[model samples]
Target: MDAIPYLNIILRLTIWFLLTADLSVANIIIGISIAFLLPRHFASPEPLREWMRVLWEIIIAIPQAYLEAIQIMLRPHDEEEIVRERVKPKRTPGLIFLDIFLITFTPKTIVLKYEEQGWYKVHRVRRKISDQ
Candidate 1:
């Protein structure tokens, strides 16, 4: 069995405990049952390395997002444009969702749509350059 299912269950249980704030035996059982019973859509299970790469990307994006926000604030005069960008070829629904979230989390870019042909229609804002 892949570790992803176990990880999912663990995450669900954590959320359950956090939300219910009850660590009683009955609540533990209920949380475990709910975690297992919850519907999961499994795509052709992505390799563990791929998942790790996505996780690393997410970590890197946090500081990048802060930098982008600072840049946006310092340069208020910006131009917005839509651009098409290629996405990873092997994309699952979870990966696509995460990709969109990462892109949109940054202040300067938002993913408008994911195309059928593995492209992202991205809306981007950049500081406009002017002749001084």
Candidate 2:
């Protein structure tokens, strides 16, 4: 019984509320029950510092995502390409999920899959550069 479990429950409950858009007592009860009942598997303990770093990255990604969306809309010539990105070391399930979520949250990129040896297969769109 650590803070991780409590945090997980809170996160799940928040997501449930957001998805359902319900504030009724029954919905709250069901959301709490489901959050508690969901299975969590972690290979090792995730440090609070690492979790906070990921949370900070998530917060930063929101504005970055909006900017990317605006750039994509404004740029007329763009190119799409698949690229491999190196993942951060010592990733837990939650961290990995957040990594993927952060990458995919942006308008210009989506993670296709995780490759062997800590690489993410990402599809990205960028403005086409012109030779001057």
Candidate 3:
């Protein structure tokens, strides 16, 4: 009954239909039905101010992350160099989830696993000049 839930369903239906790219009435109906049936575990509906702040931070950091990826790729790894870094605990589960997704967007590093100790197991490609 809430506007937010209706909006959420509409958004999900739109995205689903768009991705599927079938404009048939049946498909549209299915999309709408599924959207309504899907359980919504939405992130906390905190103030937009905090969300905007986080978004700005991510935008500012993305370029630096891309640059680091480029540098790592350009550097010759004559032998395979894989480094693992332990990520520090984030303030919230949402932040940790966001960070995992953001880090995966970078080229030279991939998240291998999440450790029990609240550290991420990241596999980074690094080459030591001394090794060559």
Candidate 4:
């Protein structure tokens, strides 16, 4: 209701019009006409601000993570390498059972497969929006 409080609404409308303007200058004219024709709702700005921040962070983090994954994947590695297990092999049945139980219960990451000379994949979903 105060001066310049309507700035974001004006800016968003301008963006929407600009987005639609590629059709022609007629669209640009139409977009401009709409700014005047539309009444300002002046809704509370908090929800919009929170969503903007969340969307922005997601836009930034997703590509960064992808780039990181690519970097790790493309890094040079020796075709043949040997490493010693830091701990001696265990023969405990209870520990294995407990491990299985925990892995099954955990949600975000899932173990695809595990074995000697086999591959294991962990799938994780990034939570972007928090439940209010």
Candidate 5:
């Protein structure tokens, strides 16, 4: 049920990012090539009302997230150990709200990388302190 909405968002983002990054004739060729390689994803059948509710939730969440980014920037980190202190509790994969907070707030300084716990690699992002 929930998975269907998430996939729709992800594919929309993918198409947007690709389109924004390139618009040349070659880009269209690459897009066509990608269409062949892409697998058909199944979205569970869900009610239209449920879908509308999910879409509204997503719309509201985006601006609040950017506001959080502002707050993270306004608040200062205590020290280097703070990073280690922050992530100690999680036993499984997927970005926590704060992890997404950092990524959203500081996209320039962060990078997402694959991590393996077993057969599946959980998505994680980390920020590097840079020397300027």
Candidate 6:
């Protein structure tokens, strides 16, 4: 496989430096060296629109998650009241991983199992009729 281009190497190095919070000359040199050495076979950039959509979903999910978590904690736990459902299948592994991470933020909902055919067994705290 061809080595990743210089632009991508620089981009990854910069990101590595930022994430590590080590901007010293020695670290920068090491980052650059590792960036060039690492394989970038799966570095496909996502479209701007997809990133925006993901951001919007996160913005909406945050408040919903907080509210649901509070409700779950306040209510008495009942095994019979838990809900189970399978969500739609995601086309890509990245999307599946993202969905799992995002949805698990809410305490009311927990992913119990993941299987092929997009089958995800989720446990959800039952909502009160008044809250519904």
Winner by lDDT:
2
lDDT of each: 0.83, 0.86, 0.65, 0.45, 0.45, 0.63
Q: If the candidates were sorted by their TM-score against the true structure, best first, what order would they fall in? A: 2, 1, 6, 3, 5, 4
Ten consecutive residues with minimal summed lDDT in candidate 1? 3-12
State the lDDT of candidate 4 residue by residue for 1-132, as single tens digits.
Answer: 542335444555656666675657787667767766766554444344443443465456556656655654666322332222221134122222223333333333344444443223334433344469
- Candidate 2 least-lDDT 10 residues: 1-10
Instruction: Name model 3 segments beyond 4 Å from true.
Output: 1-38, 42-50, 78-93
lDDT of 6 by residue, 1-132 (tens): 332254456557756887889888998888888887886556465444554565578678899988876777888645434344565433344445446656676666777776776666777767445543
lDDT of 2 at 76: 58
Cα TM-score per model: 0.74, 0.87, 0.51, 0.29, 0.40, 0.53
- Report the C-alpha displacement of residue 19, candidate 6, in angstroms: 12
Which candidate gets the maximum TM-score versus the true structure? Answer: 2
List pairs with backbone clashes in candidate 1.
none
Instruction: For candidate 1, write residues 1-132 as lDDT tens digits.
Output: 787666557757976998999999999999999999988877786677776787689789999999988887887846889999888988876667668878887888999999988999999998788889
lDDT (C-alpha) at residue 27 in model 6: 89
Candidate 5 Cα outliers beyond 4 Å, as residue runs: 1-20, 42-52, 77-132
The candidate 5 region of ten consecutive residues with least summed lDDT is 79-88
Model 5, span 81-127: residue lDDT tens = 21222342332222232243334334223324323432222232334
lDDT of 2 by residue, 47-117 (tens): 87887888899899999989888887787536889999998988887778889988998888999998768
State each model's C-alpha RMSD to the native.
4.1, 1.9, 5.5, 19.8, 8.8, 6.6
- Against the true structure, candidate 6 has what lDDT? 0.63
Candidate 1 C-alpha error for residue 52, in Å: 0.6
Error at 32, model 2, angstroms: 1.4
Clashing pairs for model 4 are none
**Candidate 3: clashing pairs of residues:** none
Backbone clash pairs for candidate 5 read: none
